[model samples]
Target: MGDDHSAARPLRADARRNRERVLQIAQEALASDGLTISFDEIARRAGFGVGTVYRHFPTKEALFEAVLLGRIERFVADARALATAEDAGRAFFGWFARVVEQAAANQALCDMLDGGSQAGPQVGLRPGSTLADDFGAALGRLLARAQRAGAVRADLTGRDVHDLLRGCLTAERRSLARGGAVRMAEVFCDGMRARTY
Candidate 1:
């Protein structure tokens, strides 16, 4: 019988590097150019051929999904690192800002992932292992800690906090820029803190 390991297609070291480069470039393109960036431009910038790019990511939607998912994983890992903040409120605000920024970028990703767009199906995505869930869990942990410390109100669930931030991100994109977004997040955080009894 053939070895189980050999049955799998092992990515050569160069292929692995190229794949990672494609993901990084895709993120830059999405951040700078939004969802409609050209896959051909991405391939040229990454020093990989069009075929190589397609080999790593089959379509434009797939490339965007990979970029979004990759950023989410990194965002989650970063949020977990904030579990040791000096002030619970600061910690909460810190991650709240992170979520807002990511969501601003992910609005396009959500359109594709949630069936709100015409982007074709993407491969390799599992049911629940998305950046959205990862960030949501991290935010939940932070919010719970903050509420327990009386830094946030008890009436607000993590879902409420997330939805609130999503609204802020979406709104800021249409009419405001980065400074407006920072102030908006601070205002929301202040409102979430419980007043002394």
Candidate 2:
């Protein structure tokens, strides 16, 4: 039984690698072509058999949710890293800009993360998922630190930060010209800064 288990380990590792590759390809395809891109296309791009893709993701919705969750998780990690920066204000604003840039590049992902009523069902993210909570906590920490440092307004909350980021999404959706979103982000950062008489 031990030998059998040991032998199966390699198969499991290979399966994990295949799943990761499929997800990577799916993200790129979905970002470039939207959800209409076929699973066969994703499989071809991943260099995996269609069966392998189905074996891992069963449905397009599942694959999409996986991709969305993976992206959110990475963003959460980035937020956490930014939380440790010496310049709290710079870290928060920098992360905000990065998120906006990402949203500009991948509008669908922005919609999913924004968790608007229209996007919840499509992305399979219910309210208060662990991923959402983690992201919120990270943002909360950053906001609190910036506020404490007197770099940002004390009245601002995590929800406010989220709303501002959503504004960036709106700008992107409107096809705001290049650098427009960054300028909007800068305006938001300026608004959030603590005022001195």
Candidate 3:
């Protein structure tokens, strides 16, 4: 999903195909192995040479950043779409749960959200960047809509919700039993729900 938007000439057809293949392979590896997997392993899995992998992404950090940005873009798109739902509370909570579940299963996402990776500080997403801002803005819109509908607690801010999400991810990541993450997410949703007198 990463593209070259620089002033450089466009890639040849074969080169473009190879780049896409490497990105796809790296995406899968990040999901399963986080940043622990090497470019050599990616090259081997991609059925290409290491030089091919380096041609597109000279460093492991570059490839990881590209993959992470792509994933975040997709998530932001989903949040934007969900913001239009008739049931604002369900839309917000449902999307939240799905994100937690998916991230719990994804090593790269978990590590990124945790604020660092085993590979080093340069490999993870930084706060206040365009990618984070886009996601936050989309989520903030959903939160505001839910609050206006009286489906969510009025006292909660977007940052509060994000903190809660991080907590849910942490709980899920640390839970020893299966379905712990799902259960914890449900608890969070319940806590976020508005109370009726």
> Higher-TM-score candidate among 1 and 3?
3
Off by over 4 Å in 1: 1-11, 102-131, 175-182
What does candidate 1's lDDT look like per residue over 1-197, in tens digits? 46765655465766888899999898888777776778799989888789999998877877787777666576678778877676877788888776665656555543433333334455223336555577678878888888888888989997798668756666656535544534566666777889997
What is the TM-score ranking, best to worst?
2, 3, 1
Model 2 RMSD, rounded to 1 decimal:
2.1
Candidate 3 similarity to native, TM-score: 0.87
Predicted structure 3: lDDT: 0.84
What lDDT tens digits, residue by residue, belong to model 3 across residues 1-197? 13464433355767988988999999999887878899999999999999999999999989987887787778789999998999999999998888888877676776676555444687555688787888889889999999999999999999899889888887877672454425678889999999997
lDDT score, candidate 1, position 24: 88
Error of 1 at 68 (Å): 0.4
TM-score of predicted model 1? 0.78
Q: Between which residue pairs do clashes occur in model 1? A: none
Clash totals, every prediction: 0, 0, 0
lDDT (10s digit) by residue, model 2, range 1-197: 99999999999999999999999999998788877889999999999889999999989988988998888788889999888799998888888878776766665687677783545475843558887789889889999999988889999899888888887677765656454434566776788889986
